[model samples]
Target: MTQFAAEMIGTFFIILLGNGVVANVVLNGTKGNNGGWIVITTGWALAVFVGVVIAAPFSGAHLNPAVTLALAMAQKFSWAKVPLFILAQFTGAMLGAVAVWLVYKDHFLKTPDKGLKSAAFFTSPAIRNNSSNFFSEVLGTFVLIFVIFYFTNAEMGNDKTPIGLGSLGAIPVAFLVWAIGLSLGGTTGYAINPARDLGPRIMHALLPINGKGSSEWNYSWIPVAGPLVGSALAALLYLWLRI
Candidate 1:
């Protein structure tokens, strides 16, 4: 696969499995329904592994736009390719979310909790404090990107692509995500990626599901803005450390 197509396919499975787990846990009457937080977190970690392993050979599996931006800022990725990668990630996320919706259509109709339906699509704050929520996302992404910077002895691939934990294999990164989800995800569900949250949330708005309720556009900016800010900070800090 080409780089763009690899990115799209990578992110497609990322959201497909990630959101599929949420739907399994929260939507009504599924076999995995009510599986609780550990199941959700574990599933997302595995989802990351699946996406990375598939896309790493071609696109380096950035999957998250924040990761792409951080690599660009760190001079590990070309600015020219940033937009293309991000577009693929967003498109993949949307398509994956649509798949989730279609698979869970019956459960969605049976489930009356609008919040639960929304939870399957995007993250929301447990406490709803804007500043706190933003900080939560930023902090979670900081851990993700910062630790990623030190994942292996090398940082960038030969052609200036961001080679993430892929160089070291997918297991370490999977554990990293599992750690983030278990430790820091409680507050804002640890979106840590602009495309991951925004694209699916957009689908939630457009999809014709019964009792799907509010898209929560008012708080949508936090996941995007916070992850960007955190990734930038991680890049800058990593650069300074190198100096």
Candidate 2:
């Protein structure tokens, strides 16, 4: 598959399953209803695994824009290709979100709580503290990109090259995401990827969901900016350590 198509398809699955779990748990009624935090985290981890396995050979599975930025910053990926990769990631994320909504349309209508409906589309802070929320995202993403640097040993480029162990190579990243979600996700839902949060959030605003309420645009920047800042910091640190 082409890199663009691979990224789009991969992120499509990420949102399809990741937000899907939220819809199943938070919406009015479903088999996974109230499956709780562990279920949500596990679902997201598996989503990452699936996405990475599908896209790694073609796009290095930089399904998250923060990851693409960090790879460029670390000199492992081409700056020239950054924008294309990011566009593909966002496209895939938005499409994935739409798929989730379609799959859970009935439940979305049944769920009266606007917040619950929004939860299936984007992340929101458990407690709204701007600085604290930003810090949580930054720290969570720092852990993500920093660890990923080590995983690739600073050598994996965004070019279409197969990653190690094929499908099994995706495991470490899945576990890393799971760890971040379990340990640090409570504060701000661990929106460690700009495209992952903002893309679907845009969709939440545009889609015709009943009583979906405000898109929470005011607080949207943190998820995008925080991850970018964290990614740059992690890349800088990795470069410095190498030096």
Candidate 3:
């Protein structure tokens, strides 16, 4: 398959599994309805694993716009490829959100809490404030991408790494995601990746679902903008500190 196809498929599963867990946790009632933070973090880590495994050989399985941009800034990835990768990632994320809606349609109708419904599709804060929420997102992505840069440099030189983690990297990354969520996600739901939050959010607005409220456009920019800034900074810092 071509790079676009690989990227689309990779990003599809990333958001599908990532947002799927949120839906399972926050929807009216289900097995994972009350699964809590641990579930969400583990699901996201597994989602990354799945997408990376599938797209690693063909396209490196970015599945994240911030990641694409940060790598481009580092000169490891071509600027020309960044747009196509982001497009594919967004498309895949939208498809994933649609799947989540279909699977949770009945529960969505059952849930009267608009926040819960929105939480399943995107993110909302336990405590909503502009500066704090935005800073949290930036810090989260900075840490996440900093670690990513470390791993990429450690394993794959300056460019993006191939995704086959051989079941070894899985536990560690999952644990790290778990730590991030357990420690930091409470305030703002840890939307450290732009695509992870925004794509599903767009779908939340577009999809015909019950109890869906305003897309929370007011706070939407934080996740996207903060992560980009954070990831870019992290990449630069990593280059200076580690390289």
Candidate 4:
């Protein structure tokens, strides 16, 4: 239960801050309106840092269900706990999206572009290329989870808790996310966490956000399926390398 709450809280902040940046940048009249990609990515990176720091002690900060699934596949985490962790992450993400919606309710009203409003809650492909978009997510998450496997290894997090990266500190994991965002995120906004994208997306569908656009359900499966596939691949490689 402690672990569950930890992940839930961590994911809540993840969406609140991560999506909050999008709302600020894209929504009309916000101070951060038109802040650009760097601002959004940077905000998400910092959000991860803070959230990981908060959840590390109790849950190892597997705020993303993809990470949880990958860890279990690599034999670092137990299968029994995967469902619980994923549920917590999704619940937390939904609550966080709700917070973002409420916080930016006025902004949503001020902003007339429904696409911008939807962007604040979910990821969409810049080009709408099915193969390329799915590939982008797969490649991005492979880097994320593969590198994550190395973070808590023999030397980096040495003498720290061996469970996960934050055992060393949250900064490295944060920096890892920052690097991924800066490098590979251009393709699909790097929806590396299924819960992060899907949970908020579901909220967008259910919420009464005056003019929120299509949830893009047709492309929805990419973010979820791609991350899971990529994480699984990362786990397989981790095992193959015996690292």
TM-score of 4: 0.95
Question: Model 2: per-residue lDDT, tens digit, 41-114?
Answer: 99999999999989988777888888888878877777898888889989999999999999999999899999
The candidate 3 region of ten consecutive residues with least summed lDDT is 159-168
lDDT tens digits by residue: candidate 1, 201-237: 9999999988789999999999999999999999999
lDDT on C-alpha atoms for all candidate structures:
0.92, 0.87, 0.78, 0.88
User: RMSD (Cα, Å) of candidate 3?
Assistant: 2.6
Ranking by lDDT: 1, 4, 2, 3
RMSD of each: 1.2, 2.0, 2.6, 2.2
TM-score of 3: 0.90
In candidate 4, clashing pairs total 0
lDDT of 2: 0.87
lDDT for 98 in candidate 3 is: 93
TM-score of each: 0.97, 0.95, 0.90, 0.95
Q: What is the lDDT of residue 166 in candidate 1?
A: 65
Q: Residue 37, candidate 2: how far off, in angstroms? A: 0.1
